[model samples]
Target: MNLKNLKGDVLELGTHKGGSTILFAKYLQNINDPRKIYAVDWFKGLPYSDEFGNTDEKKKAKGRLNDTSKEFVESKFKQFNVDDKIIVVDGLFEETLYEKLNDKVFSFVFIDCDLYKSAKFALEYIDNHLEKDGIVFLHDYSNFLNRPKYDWGIIKATDEYVREHKVQFTENPIAHFQKITSI
Candidate 1:
């Protein structure tokens, strides 16, 4: 992703351990781009799974991946010296997405919420604020090992959005959806 050409800031949902968030910040730093990256996450791990058929009981368990905290992610960012480029928002998507970032516009969004409802909400909410040439990266859209070992909510939510918006969707390991000005 060419962050230099993008107009608005970056938004990353589901930032666990700040891995991808740090990468984005470093890229922006290298490019001398002043755009800020907002990393939103509960930081408590996966919420209760949705009523998707592909989700298993283990995956459905709330707090399944609640090992990382906001402070841990912040420490990682500080270690990478990219803490200046990121703002970590701590809360559930339903509680924080709009309340905290409603006024911001995003040129790129990385969605890794790992659940249908979370992905769907992020997609719909970001669509209005995304730039015409904005890019959205959906993690786990193809699941692990390109097999159905995990929940298929990402794929289903992304497909539904693409179909509804008539936008282009590409799955090169991870799914990429670019916003089109005109269909």
Candidate 2:
């Protein structure tokens, strides 16, 4: 997607170590737009990793991927000089999403968390806030070919959400869903 043309404020569900957050901010900067990108995440890691499977591989990943901090993430924003264009909302998706971002309208949303519950909640939470015809970018939606046996919760959740809401989407690797009507 062309980040240069993204309208309204941005919203991201998984900030992780601020990689994508930095990129998003840089894109906005390149366009010389002063839009804010609300990057939301716990800054810790996945609440659970059991969604992958009941095998040892999944168990080994429990509490894994938790190497980040608000201070560290903020540092990246500062380094990129996009700190002023980013708002950090720290907490689990369930606890912080609506509470912190309900007031804003978004033209683009990036859902990077790869879990069923997280994906579902993120989509629903952004429903009222995403502007008409705004697009939602979903990661892990087309990972089936590479990680077939791994947790497919994200794919499942996204499929269900789109099907239930009759949302249309186009997918290459990332699935982009454009909001057509109120869900």
Candidate 3:
């Protein structure tokens, strides 16, 4: 995604505790742009429960999101001094994205939702609202390969959609985007 200053909107899905959002806020502040930066998450913890392997870690993560995430995200946004410019949507993308992105186009979107459904939802939004030449950076592709069967499913889905739609992709897009734009 385009990591440069004060351009179009940027959204991050699955922000664990707003760290990456904070970084984006700072960059936008540096460039003096009033465009919105959004952080969307359910904040209800991971989708699966104890059935998956490594139950303890998932439980602990759920406890943090369930218990302390709101205060932590608010505090961090203040600390970063971009609180007003950041839009926090505290729900699943299925619940919030179309409303949030209504009539708006984005320059950058990061998808880190890990789960197949959320990832697919994020990709759908990117497909519809992302500006021409916009970039979508997806995290956890390695997990998709090495973790579970469904992990690979979203990868195939995204690849198929991109190919069928004829989307352009560049490696290291966050950096390369500054020097380029779409046809």
Best by lDDT: 1
Give the per-residue lDDT digits (tens) of candidate 1, residues 4-57: 676789999989888999988998898788999999999887876655527476
Error of 1 at 94 (Å): 0.6
TM-score for each candidate, following the candidate numbering: 0.89, 0.86, 0.71
Ranking by lDDT: 1, 2, 3
Candidate 3 lDDT (Cα, 0 to 1): 0.64
- Model 2 residue 8 lDDT? 69
Cα shift from native, residue 154, model 3 (Å): 4.8
Q: Which stretches of candidate 1 lie over 4 Å from their true place?
A: 1-3, 53-59, 143-150
Supply the TM-score for candidate 2.
Answer: 0.86
Model 3: ten consecutive residues of lowest lDDT? 171-180
* Candidate 2 residue-wise lDDT at 72: 93
Worst 10 residues of 2 by lDDT: 143-152
Q: Write the per-residue lDDT of candidate 3 for residues 1-183, one digit (tens) a residue.
A: 334532568888888788788887888788787778888887776553322223355323333445436567878899878798788888778888997666767787877665545566677777667766677776644344245423323454455555566566443312111213342
Question: What overall lDDT goes with each candidate model?
Answer: 0.82, 0.79, 0.64
Q: Which prediction has the highest TM-score against the true structure?
A: 1
Q: What is the lDDT of residue 94 in candidate 3?
A: 88
- Can you write out model 2's per-residue Cα lDDT over 28-126, one digit (the tens) per residue? 889788889999988888776646434566445446669998899999899889899999999999998777776788888999887766787888887
